[model samples]
Target: MTKPGRTLLKVQGLTKRFGGLVAVNNMTFDVHEHEVLGLIGPNGSGKTTTMNLISGAFPPSDGSITMNGQRLSGLAAHQIARRGVSRTFQLVRVLPGLSLVDNVVAGAAFGYRKRWGAEAEQFARGLLERIGLGDHMHLPVGSLTYIDQKRLELARALAGEPEVLLLDEWLAGLNPTELQEGIDLIAELRREGRTIILVEHVMDAIRSLCDRCVVMNSGAKIAEGTPRDVLSDPEVIRAYLGDE
Candidate 1:
């Protein structure tokens, strides 16, 4: 089976600015198919802004983004998602009134609108089981623990069948065991041939999961290399320390 990470998503000259403040500065990178690329930075480093641009939350100030040779510039978020891209937010977006199955079904519906009828619900049920939420299929999303909610978000994104999945701080609030589970889940996704681009503050996850990493400081790409190389660079170290 062909892996999603084997394909390449090219982001070139991607820049975004709010007035005189540049949130992302001419950043360029490639997310390889079937690989995990970790994106790390301190507060206000434009990590979220970069994710927003690539996911089509807004148009880039100046740049071109392409996936599988398709131009992604000027597309809306949903449109981009339909084009084989999906993202999980830092805040965990799920419907409180919906059941676990329903939340994932909603995601399936987004990509399978034309295939409605019994098929949609059937597909959602299968996906929920695959995501390890079979037992909670009928439980209200609001009643699940925080960890379960995070899993729901993952299942929703997975429902899109995206070639590229962007995870924004997915492990932020988890305890040690939960964090490990999340890490293993992501790693398993990679093994299942999914490509992932993760923005995280957790160094341990980045170190264990990413094949390569990109470091940003103040909205600019300061370094891109192996985790050890970038993490140990004097410049990168100082940047983390708030020095120029």
Candidate 2:
């Protein structure tokens, strides 16, 4: 676990483009160790693109990324994963044919290739329990509810034992109760001292769960501060169309 004073990840002038369009433009930020930093923006504001850049899904068009003070600008996604960064997409990415526990085990196995075999299984099993999916361990991911699939995605990310976790709209499509439960699960992860960068449009979740928020518009950051302050900023309000 990272201590409070450490900077888990830092982004400087990060930008991404596809042909003529800039999806993320000259953005920068820092995620403190063990802190939940929320990333919010309008639908096309490049939030997911930003997540992709940070997690090494693609190299940036320009700029730098660092994690635990190690340069991460050009690494491949798997290499970044091996270096203690993991992520979950807004769309759950579980392997439907595999059991929920088996899916987590695959992640744990990759991250713990150097550990003893039994130890890896133990770690995977424990992670499933921790993420509240222990009872569904034997069930195929295809049979799980959407909420449970979400949980499995989280469990897979956690199984990697990442130093920084990028969560992309983990609450989307959840029912009210499931959303609250998922919020509580995120809080539980925070308590475990994991550093997180969360991209969520759900204002209630942002207010209740984020330590601070970064708001973007038109593929560029517009404001960042405490949730209350950011939410009330005239620019942020304008960007959100007054909570459209």
Candidate 3:
């Protein structure tokens, strides 16, 4: 088990409003270095919205976000990526026309440290190989299966060598065996001390990966603690299973 270190990301009183609806309300949390923090909730609970705010895909309507004490709330998505934050989308996104290696190379060239030319291509290739896409490096992304595309997206995110990796349901569409493979891959990442914020509906993955969990319902946090504790919390149970 990796012991969590200093606070790496801080989200304080974050809120977002879309017209009359509040997507996230006054949420606050701290993600420690080397920790896998699970953001778990039922559908429509603002989990992805919160992730969007953190990744700069959507700016918060209120409150602040900081990484290692540097303000991140106002930065653009690309700027945030350059500052060591990388993410895979809830829906798989890959460059359909580009070869797998080119897709990852894009990430390496534009990511945090900005590798270029041979260095960038080499780094991208290694990441693809690590993520099990080496044999298909030159193939167009459109030719890959859904799970393989997911793998490519993750590799692209990792190509940046990000300080914090946000995985939004990277395990969503896997079959039983593929799910286990996905889980094991993530476990390896955890062992490598990657700091991650995972927004997922798979309880098994949550239990196996998360050091702690924060549960939300209707865009507001309802519970937080270890997976064992939070999963058993009455309110969290109610949020998922409904009141009886």
Candidate 4:
């Protein structure tokens, strides 16, 4: 676990382009060790593109990504994973045909951080238990509820034991009680001291979990600060919240 205030990940002049469209535009920021940094923006503001760049899903069109003094821009996703960066997709990516435990175990076996063996299986089982899916370990993921699929995604990400975890709208669909449960799970992840970059629309989760926030619009960052401050900013209100 990294201490607060030490820059663990550095993104400088990050930009991404798809043909004529600029998906992300010259955004720069530092994610401190163990900071729950919220990345919020209106739709098409480049939030997901930013996540992809940080996690090496795609190379940047311009600028750099560095984690603890190492350049990460040119690396492949698996290479980046070995470097201790991990993430969950906004659309859950679980293997529907596999048993739940096997789904996590497959990821665990391939991660750059750990060896695949009995020990790894045991670790995967432990993660399922912690994510509240141990009883369903033998069940095919196709039969699981959406919420449980989300939980399985999280557990797969955790199985890699990453230093930085990027969550893309992990709380998009849930009731009030379910939302709080999601919030509590995030709080617990924070307690474990993982550096988190949360790309989410849920304000209550933002206020509850984020130590700081970065807001974007038109593929470029427009405002950044604490949740209370950013949410109240006139520009943010106009760009995202609308006059109310």
Candidate 5:
């Protein structure tokens, strides 16, 4: 088992309301350094909403978010990103017009430590190579197949050198083979001790990659613990499968 390090990110009493509808309600969780924490739940459970709040896509209506004990809730998206938080969207997003290398270079130049010029290019290339996109570095992002596009997005996210990485349903649309490949790539990241908050429905990936899991439903956390314990909890089962 991988023992978690100190708490790197903390989400406390986080809530978001779109008018009368609550997207995330009083949600709280901690992500430890060098640990992969799975945020798993049924559809519309606010998993992605929680991720957005942490990554600064949207501010919380109530509560706070902190990283390394520093407040992050009020910062803008770019500001939060520069503070060592990076994320991939539930929908894959890339600069389609840019070449693979340039797209990743953008991430390197703007994110975290902020590399530039040839250094940024070199760093981007190395990340692409690590993600298996090196051979296609010069290709336009739109030209790659769907799975490869997903790979490119990951490389870009990693180029930022984030202390905390958030992945929202990253394995959603893959075929079995592609899913396995994706799982393997994530597992490799875990071995390197990356701190990741993964919002996923894939049970196999959740079981294999997560050090702990926080399960939610209707925008509120319902269970949290090791994957084995939470997945078997009666409340969690009821949330996913409903009352019999």
Candidate 6:
């Protein structure tokens, strides 16, 4: 059995309802320090809702969220961000008219220490370079391709210098080469000791990056184990991979 280290994030009986629909139901899991946790399931399986709940995109209807032993359930998104959590959204959002670097600078303004002026731009620029957006820094964000826009979202999130990073389908639109580049970038973050929760459909990235994975179905956790184990389970196979 793999031993878990210090708990970085904890969710107990987490549930969210949008009117009559229970989008997430009693989901419970813990993310450990310096480990990548994969949250995977088929489309509409509540993966993104889980990320939103953890990142404070909105309040949960029920359950508790704790980080480093402190309650985080009722905090606003930015307040939660201040507590060392940063996340990339399922839909990449960037200011269309802003220069590429400026979009990241906006994130630095709200994330943690609140960097400003040239210092913020310099820091944001460095992150843009790390995420492979350096050459396009002066261009309007709308000019970038879909894959590059995703990288910009990641750069913005990293500007926060977060301890725990939650990524929701941030690798959606990449080709094979760009996919490998993203996988390498995530590996580097893991090497730097950042705890990550990755919600992705790409099995290759999950296998390469996650030490363990949690499988969800219909808003409930169906299995939890090493990537090989969970992916091979009969239920996981049935729910996801069909009868193959």
lDDT against the true structure, per candidate, is 0.85, 0.86, 0.93, 0.89, 0.93, 0.89
Model 5: CA > 4 A from native = none
lDDT of 1 by residue, 48-71 (tens): 899999889879999999999999
What is the TM-score of each predicted model, taking all chains together?
0.93, 0.94, 0.99, 0.96, 0.99, 0.94
The positional error of residue 187 in candidate 5, measured at the CA in angstroms, is 0.5
Candidate 3 residue lDDT tens string, 72-135:
9989999999999999999998988788888898899888989999999889889988989889
Query: Which portions of model 1 miss their true places by more than 4 Å?
Result: 1-7, 112-115
lDDT of 4 at 207: 88
What count of clashes does model 1 give?
Answer: 5
Q: Which parts of model 2 are misplaced by more than 4 Å? A: 1-3, 112-116, 242-244
Q: If the candidates were sorted by their lDDT against the true structure, best first, what order would they fall in?
A: 3, 5, 4, 6, 2, 1
Clash number by candidate, in order: 5, 0, 0, 0, 0, 0
Candidate 3 Cα deviation (angstroms), residue 85: 0.6
RMSD of each: 2.3, 2.2, 0.7, 1.7, 0.7, 2.0
Better of 1 and 5 by lDDT: 5
Q: What is the Cα-based lDDT of residue 72 in candidate 3?
A: 96
The CA lDDT at 194 in model 1 is 79
Q: Which stretches of candidate 6 lie over 4 Å from their true place?
A: 1-4, 242-244
The model with the greatest lDDT is: 3
Q: Please give, for residues 1-244, the per-residue lDDT of candidate 4 as tens digits.
A: 2257699999999999999999999999999998999999899899999999999899999999999999999899999998888889989999887777777887687665775888888889999999899898878888888788999999989888888999999998877887888899998998888899999999989988998899999999999998999999999989886767
Q: Candidate 2 at 217: error in angstroms?
A: 0.7
